[model samples]
Target chain A: MESLLERYRNLVVLLAILVAQIVGLAVQVRRTSAGVNTLDSSDASGVRLIRLWANTVVSPPERLIHSGFGLFAGAWTNYIDLRHVRAQNRDLKQTVDRLRLEEAALLEDARQGQRLEALLGFQEKYIYTTVAAQVYGTSGSDRSHVFYIDKGARDGLKPDMAVITPDGIVGKVRDVFSHTAQVLAVNDTSSGAGVILESTRIRGILRGDVSGRLEVVGILADERIHPGEKVLTAGGDLIFPRGLPVGVVEKVVRDPDRDAFIDVMVRPAAHLERLDEVLVITSTEPRFSPQQQQDLSVSAAEEESVPAAVKDQMKASEIMAEKLPGLIDPNLAPDQQPLHDSSNPNPVVQPPQPLHPDRFSPGSAPDDVPEPDAGSPPDAQPRKPSALPSANGGSTLPGSNSTPEATPQRNL
Target chain B: MALLGADLRRDLEIHRYPLLVYTLVPLTALVLQAWLPRVVGRYDWFDLPLVITIYFALGRRSPIQGTLMGAAMGLFEDALSHNAIGINGIAKTVVGFLAASVGIRIDVENTTVRILLTLGLSLFSSALYLFVNRFLLDLATEWSWLTELLRAVGNALIAVVLFPLLDRLQSRD
Candidate 1:
C-alpha cells in the first residue's frame, strides 16, 4: 500500500488540487444560482471575501499609477501644449455663442413641455447627482467585461448605480469595495437594460451578445427598425434614468434562433473600449430642474386661480401667455390687455410674475414672435401683442394659424 | 530497462531560479495582465500569466513543483479577474502538470520546441477555461476558433521574446 501511494504521488496530488478547485467552483456556482446574481445585485451579500481581499490588494497600485499618469499628462498638456490654445479658444467661443442661441430655443421648448407635464401630473426621474470616477484597470479577461473605477463605497458608491459618460451610457456598478468598484460594461453578456428606439418608440431589452456587441432583443420582426435610430434608456430597470442616450441601432437582422424576434445591433454611444473617466449616477431621484420647478409653481398658481372649464377652453396661445407674461405687448395699457374674467370662456389670466423674464428682451416682443419679412405683404406686419383675443372669443398668436383641435398635445 | 532509465534521466535537465525570480515573475505577470488592458484597451490577445506558467513549468521539469506553481499562479490570476477562483486554477494546474511531464521526455532547450509547447499549452488552457466556464459552471462564453488560434499564435510570439529573457534569470550554480 505504501509503495503504491508513493508511486502514484504526482497523480494523487494533481487529483487533489483539481478536486479542491472543482469544489470551490461548485460552491460559487451554487451561491450564484441561489439568488446571488452578482451582475445585478446591489449589495455586498453576493460578493466573496476573497474578491474583496483581491480588490484591496490590486486597486491601490492601479490608483497610484492612474494618478501618476493623470498628473504627468496634465502637466504636459497644461504647460507645453499651447500651440493650438488660441485657435481652440476662438473655436470654443464661437461654439459657445452658437450653443447659447440653441440653449435659449431649447429652454423655451423645455419650459413648454414642463408646463404640459405639470398639467398631466407626470413625474420624471432626473440624474440628481453623480460621482466622477477614473477608470484604472479592467478584469483582464475578455470573457468578463468589467473595469475598476477609482471611487467606491467610501465615496458613497453603491452597486447597480448607473455609470455614464458625456457621450452616452456606459454600464452599472456590479461590486463595490472600500475605495474601488467594478463596473460591468453595457456590452458584457450579463448586463442588460430597458431601451427604447428614439424614432419609432419601439421598446426592447438591451443585452450584450457573446462577442461583446450590444443587441436589442424582445422587439418583433414586423416592426420597422432602421439603422441610425437613436436608442434611449427606458428606465424600467430602475438602474438608469429614463431617456438617457444609450446607443444607435447599427443593424437589424432576423434572429437565427427565433424567427418571430429580430436582433437589433447597437453601436454604443460611449467608447466602451477606451474609457478613461466615467460619471457614476449616485442618485436617480425624481427631482425637477430649477426651471421646471418654477414652471410647475407658476402652473400650480395659475391652475388654482383658473377653473378647469376655463383651462380646458384656453388655447395654446393663451396658455403660452399665462406662462410667459413678458410676451404681453408693452404698448398696451393695463385695461387694453386681457383681464381675469371668470364669465369669459377665453379669458387670459396673467400670472403675478413672468415665469422666465430673461427669455424676452426688455420692452420688446418675445424672441419667438416672428419679425415681418421684408419680402412679405403689408398685412404681414408684426402684431402689437404676441397673443391677442380673436373676434371669435378664442385667443390667437401672431403667426400661428393652427386651430385649438389641431394643436398637438404631448403624450405621456 | 536499467540502460533505458539511465538515458531518460540523463535527457532530463532541471533548471532552477532565484526565489525572487520565481515569486516576482508571476506577480509581475499578473499585475501587468490586470493593468495593461486599461492602457492598451481590451488587449485579449496576450495572456502573460499563462505564458509565465508554461515557461516555469517547462523549465522546472518536476510534476509536483509544476502543478503547485500552476495552482498558485492560476488562483492568483483568478483572484485578479472576475472569474470564480478555481476555474483558472484547474485549467492551469492541468497544463502545468502536463508541461512538466512532457518536459522530462523532450529536449526543451530548442527554441522551436519551446514555442510549440507554449502554443499547445496556451490553447489547452483556453479550452479548459471555456469548458469549466460553459459546462462546469454554466457560464456564457464567446468561443471563436479563429480568435483562439490567433491568441495562441500571439502567446507563442510573446514566448519567443519572453523565454529568452526568463532564461537569463536561471541560477548558474
Candidate 2:
C-alpha cells in the first residue's frame, strides 16, 4: 500500500486538494442558503470581511494610479482648452444673459405652480442631505453588477438610500462598509424600483435582466403604453421619491408567459456604464416648501371667510331660496335662525352657538348689529339658518306658514 | 521538430520560475484584473488571473505544485471579487491539475500549442465555474455559448502575445 501511494502521490495530492476545496465550497453554499441572504439584510459577513480586506489592500494603489492619470489629462485639456477662450467666453456671456431672462419668466410660473400644488396638498420632495463620493471602481465581473464608492458608513451612507447624479437616478446603496459602500446599479438583476410611465401614469416595477438591461413589469397589455415615454419613480418603494426621472421606455412587447402584462424595456437616463461621480443621499425630506407653506396658510385663512367668487355663488343660492314661499320661520326668534343653508329642503346645519335673548329683542336696531371686518372670519351669528322647507311644502318653525312674509320683513 | 513524439514521462523538460516572478506575476495579474475594467472599460472575458494560473501550472509540470498554485491564485482572485471564495478556487484547482498532467505528456512549449491550450483551459474553467455556481450554489447566471467562445478566443489572443514575454521570466531547471 505504501509503495502504491508513493508511485501515485502527485495524483493523490491533486485529488485531495480539489476535494477539500469542493467541500469548502459546499459549506459556503449551505451557509449562504441557510439563512444568510443579501436581500434579507444579513450580508454574507464572512465573505464581506474577506472582500473588505482585499479592497482595502488593493484600492490605495488603484486610486494613486487613477489620480496620476487624471492629473495628466487635466493638464492636457487645460492647455488645449485655452485656444478659443476669448471667443467662447463672449458667446457664453450672451447665452447666460438670454438664460437669465428666461429664468425670470420661469420663476414666476414656478411660484404659481407652487401655489396650486399647495392647494392640492402636494408635498415637494427635496434633497435634505447628501454626501458626494467618487466612484473608485466597479465589481470587475459582469455577473455582479455593483460598483464601489469611496464614501461609506463613516460618511453617513446607509443601505437603500438613493444614489443619483445630475442626469438621473443611478441606483441605491446596497452595502455599507467603514470607508467604502457598494452601489447596486439599477441595471443589476437583483435591484428593483417602483416606476411609472410619465405620460399615461401607468405604474410598474422596474427590474434588470441578467443581461444588464432594464425592464418594467406589471403594466397591462391593453394600457396605452408606447416607446419613448419617460419613466419616473412612483416612490411606493420609499427609497426613491416620486417623480424622479428614471429612464425612457425603449421597446414594448406582449409578455409571452402572462397575457395580461406587457414587457417594456427602458433605456436608463444615467449612463450606467461610464459612471464616475455620484451623490449618495444621506437623507431626504418630502415636505411643503416655504412658498407652499405660505400659500397653504393663506388658503386656510380664506376658508373661514370664503372666496369672493364662492360668496357670490352662495348669495345667488340664498336669493333663489327666498323666492320659494313658506320657507322662513316667523315665530322663531331672529337669533334662533339656522346659521347655514336653511333655504335648501335638507339643510346641513352646523352646530349652533347659544344666543342671548337680548340680541333678538325687538328693541335692538341696525346700529346695534355687529359688523365683521373684511379680513375677519364671518360671524357665527350672521344670517340665521334660512328657514328650511318642510316635506309638506311648509316651514318647520311654528307659525312659519301662517306669517312667512312677516318673518322676512323682520329679518331684513 | 519539437512537436515530434518524445517519451511523455522520461523526456519531459520541467522548468522552475524565480520566487519573485512567482509572487509578483500573480499579484500583478490580480491587481490588473481588478483595475483594468476601470481604465480600458469592461470586458468580462479578459481574465488575467486564469492566464497566469495556466502559465505557472504548465511550467512546473508537477500536478501537486500546479494544484496548490492554482488554489492560492484563485483564492486571492476570489478575495478581490464579489463572489464567494471557493468557487474560483475549485475551478482553478481542476484546471491546474489537468494542465500539469497534460503538460507532462505534450509539447506545450510551442507558441501555437500554448495558445490553444490556454483557450481550452479557460473555457473548461469557465464551464466548471458556471456548473458550480448554478448547480452547487444555485446562483443565477446568464450563459451564452457564443459569448463563451468569443471569450475563449479573446483569452487565446491574449495568451499568444503574453506567453512570449512571460517566457523570459521562467527560471532555468
Candidate 3:
C-alpha cells in the first residue's frame, strides 16, 4: 500500500487539492444562496479573513502608487497646465454669470415647489451627509466589477451605502473594512437597483447583464420606451435615494427569455469604467429646503395665533369675495372701502388718517386729517368736512374735541 | 516516489530563481493586476497573474512544484478578486501541472512554443472558470468565444515580452 501510494503521490495530491477546493466552493455557493434571500445582508463571512489578508497585502502599495500618481497629476494641472488657464478662467466666469441667473430662477421655482409640498405635507428622502472617497483599485477580475475606495468603516462607511459621482450613481458599498471598502459597480451582474424611466414614469428593476451592461427589466413589452429617456433611482431598494440620476435609456429590445417583458439597455451616467472619486452617502434625512422650513414654521405660528372662529370667519370672507367680486369695489384701496354689516341698517364710515401724523407739530394739523398734496389734482385733495349734528343737536366738525354720546353712523 | 520515468527526468533541465524572485514576482503581479486596470481603465484582456503562473510553471518543469505554484497564484488571485477562493485555484493548478508536464517533453524555451502554450492554457483556464461559475456555482457568466480568443492572444503577446525579462531573474548557480 505504501509503495502504491508513493508511485501515485503526485496524482493523489492533485485529486486531494481539487476535492478540497470543490468542497470550499460548494460551501460558499450554499452560503451565497442563503444570503440572497436577505438582500441587504453581508455575503460570504467565511471568506472575510482571506479577503482581509488580501486587502492588507495589497492596499498599501496601491495607496502609495495612487498618491504618487495624484502628486504628478496635481503638479501637471496646477503648474504645467497654465497655458489654458486664462481661457478656461474666462469661460468659467461666463458660465458662472449664466449659472447665477439660472440659479436665481431655479431658486424661486424650488421655493414655490417646496411651499406647495409643505402645504400638502409631503416628505422626501434627501442626501444628508456624504464621505468623499478616492477609488484606488478594483477586484482585478473582469467577472467581478467592483472597486476599492480609500475610505471605509473608519471613515463612517457601511455596507449597502450608496456611492455616487457628480454625474450620477456608480454603485453601493458591498463590504467595509477599517481603511477601505469595496464598491460593487452597478454594471456588476449581481448588482441591482430599483429604477424608473423619467419621462414615461415606468418603473423597473435595473440590473447588470453578463457583459457588464446596465439593463432595465420587468417593463411590459408594450410600454412606449424610447432612447434618451432619463432613468432615476426609485429608492425602493433602500440603498440609493429616490430621484438620483441612474442613466439614460440607450435602447429597448424585446427580451428573448420573457415574452411579456422587454429589456431596456441603459447608458450609465457615471463613468463606471473610469471612476476616480466617489461619494458614499453615510446618512440621509427627510428634509425640506431652508426656505420651506421657515415658511412651514411661520404658517404653523400663524395657525396657532388665530382662533378657530376667526379662521372660519376669514375663510368665509375669502369665499364670499370669490363669489361676489362687486361686493368690494376693486378700484378702491382696502382701507378706503366701505365696511357694511348686513345685520345693521346704518354703516359707520371710518375716515382715512394722515400718512404721517407724527411729522406734524401739535395743532399744526388735525391728528386724524391728511394734509393735501400741493402737486395733486383738485379732485384728489381732501375735502373740508361739513359740520354734523351731534346727539345734543349741536353742530360740530367730525375732528372737533366734542365727543359723540353714541357711536356715530353716517347716513348714506 | 518519482512520478516521471528516469529517462524522462534525465532530459528535463530544472531552472531555479532567487527566493526574492519567487516571492516578489507573484506579489508584484497580483498588485499590478489589481492596480493597473484602475489607472488604465478596464482593460480586462490582459491578466498578469495568469502570465506569471504560466511562465514559472513552464520553466520549473516539475509537476509537483508547478501544481503548488499554480495553486498559490490562483488562490491569491481569487483572494484579491471578489471570486470564491478556490475557483481560480483549481483552474491554475491544472494549468500548472499541464505546463510542467508539457515542459519536460518539449523545448518550451522556444518563443513560438511558449506563446502557443500560454495561449492554450489561458483559454483552458477561462473555460474551467466559466464551467465552475455557471454549472457548479450557478452564477451568471458572460461567455464569448471571440472575446476569449482575443484575451488568449493578448496573454500570449504579453508573455512574449514578459518571459524574456523574467529569464534574467534566473539564478545561474
Candidate 4:
C-alpha cells in the first residue's frame, strides 16, 4: 500500500487539490442559489463578508495611491486647463442662455400638457428626491458588470433604487454596504427594466444577454419600430419612475426562435462605460405644478359657489313668480315657460349672457334686475318682452292683458 | 547567450527568500491588479496576479509549494472580484502544479520556454475558469476563442518582458 501510494503520489495530490476546490465551490454555489430569491442587498452576506474583507484590505492602499496620484494630476490639469477655461466658460454661458430660453418654452408646454392631463384624470409619478454619488470603481470582471459608488446605506441609499445621470438611466443600486454600494449596470445579464418605445408607445422588457448586449423582448414582430427611436422607463417594475430616458433602438429584427416576438437591440443613452457620477433616486411621489395647483383651487371655489348661485337665482325666480303673474305666459306649458327670464320683463334691458351651471359666478347672472330687498334706479324698467315685434310682425307672447306700455313696472 | 543560459540555470538554484519579500511581492501585485485598471483604464485584460503566481510557481519548482501558492493567490483574487471564491483558486492550483512539474522536467532557463509556458498556462486557466463557472456554478460567461487567444498572446508578451525583470528578485544561491 505504501509503495502504491508513493508511485501515484503526484496524481493523488492533484486529485485531492481539485476535489477540495470543487467541494468549496459547491458550497458557495449552494449558498448563492439559496440566496438568489431574496433582495440582492440581503442575499449575499457570506460572499459580501469575503468581498468586504478583501475590499477593506485593498481599498486603504488603493485610496492612498489614488489620492496621491490624483493630487499631482489634478494640480497639473487644473493649471494647464485654466488657459482655455475662460473661453470655454464664455461658450458655455451662451449655451446656458439658449438652454434657458428652451427651458422656458418647455415649461409652458409642460403646463399646458398638465392642464390637459388634469382634465383627463392622469396622475404622473415624479422623481421627488435623489442622492448623488461618485462612482469609485467597477467589479473588475466582464460577467458581473457592476460599479461601486462612494455613497451607501449611510447616505440614504437602499438596494433597487434607480441610479441615473443627466444624460439617461445608468442602472439601479443592487447592494448597499456601510460606505460603498454596488450598482448593477443596465447591461448586466441579470438587470432588467420595463421600457417603452417613444414614437410607437409599444412597451417591452429590456434585458441584457450573456454577451453584455442589451435587447428588448416581448415586442411583437408586426409592430412598427424604427431605428434611433427613443426608449423610456415604463415604471411597471416600480424601481424606476415613468418616462426616464433608457436608450434608443439600434436595430429591430424579427426573432426567428420566438413566434410573435421581435428581438430589438438598444444603444443606451448614457455612456455606461464612462460613468463617473450618478444620482440614486431616494424617493418618488406625485408632483403638482403651480398651474395645476391654481387650477385645483379655482375648481374647488367653483364647486363651492355652484349651489349658492343656483339658490340665489331660484330665490329671484320665486319673487318674480309672486309679483308678475300676468308677465308669466299662462298659455304656454309649465316646462316650456321660462322661469328666471320672466323677472326681466323689460326686453330693452338686455338679459345678461346665460350662466353655465358648471362654471357659475355671482356676476354671470343679470344685474339689471334688482333684488326685491334692494331698491332699483328709476329708469331701469323698460319695454316688456311683449313689446318686441316677432319676425312675422306679431306679438310672440299674445293674448296677455299686460301690454308693453301698460305693464306695471316694478318699484325702482 | 551561452553565459545568459548558464546564468539562467544558476539562477534557478532554490534558495529561501526573506519573509518580507514572500509577503510584500504578492500583496503588491494584488494591489496593483485591483488599482491600475481604475487609473490607467482598460488594463483589466492584464492578469498580474496570474503572472505573479506563475512566476513564483516556476521559481519554486516544487509541485506541493507551487499548488499552495497558486491557491492562496487565487483566493485573494476571488475575494477582490465579485465572482465565486474557489473558481480562480481551482484553475490556478492546477496551472501552478502543472507548471512546477513542467519546470522540473524541462530546461526552464530558456526565454522561449518561459514565454510558451505562460501563454499555454494563461489559456488553460481561462478555459478552466469558464468551465467551472458554466457547468459547476451554472453561471453564464461570455466566451470567444478569438478573444481568449488574443489575451493569451498579450499575457505572453508581458511575460516575456516581466520574467526577466522578476528574475532579479530570485536568490543567487
Candidate achieving the largest DockQ: 1
Clashes of 4: 0
The value of fnat for model 3 is: 0.53
Question: Which of the two candidates, 3 or 4, achieves a greater lDDT against the reference?
Answer: 3
lDDT at position A132, candidate 4: 66
lDDT of 3 by residue, A1-412 (tens): 9998898877777788888888877766643455431111244776778878888987888788789889989999898888789999999999999999999999978975654454233223233577777789999998999999999899999999999876788999999999999999999999999998765567899989999999999999845578988899998999999899999999999999999899999999988998876788888764567877899999999898999999999889867764554555534666554434455666796656766654233453344445445576545644455556778875545554432321132110
lDDT of 4 at A157: 91
lDDT of 4 by residue, B128-149 (tens): 8898887777765788887777
The order by descending TM-score is: 3, 2, 1, 4
Which ten-residue region of model 1 chain B has the weakest summed lDDT? B1-10
TM-score of structure candidate 2? 0.39
lDDT of every model, 2 decimals: 0.79, 0.76, 0.80, 0.76
Model 4 Cα lDDT, one tens digit per residue, A41-100: 332666678778878877888788788878878987988768899999999999999999
Global lDDT for candidate 4? 0.76
Give the DockQ-based CAPRI class for model 2: acceptable
Fnat for every candidate: 0.60, 0.50, 0.53, 0.55
| Candidates 1 and 2, the one with greater DockQ | 1
DockQ of each candidate relative to the true complex: 0.26, 0.24, 0.25, 0.24
TM-score of 4: 0.39
User: For model 1, how does the per-residue alpha-carbon lDDT over A1-412 read when each residue is reduced to its tens digit?
Assistant: 9998799998999999999998877766543656442322222343367666766766776677678878988988897687789999999999999999999999978975654454233223333677778789999989899999999999999999999876789999999999999999999999999998865567899989988999999989845577888899998999988888999999999998988989999999988998877788897664678888999999999889998777777766567664555544334665565433336677796656665664233433335444445576655554455356878986556334432322232110
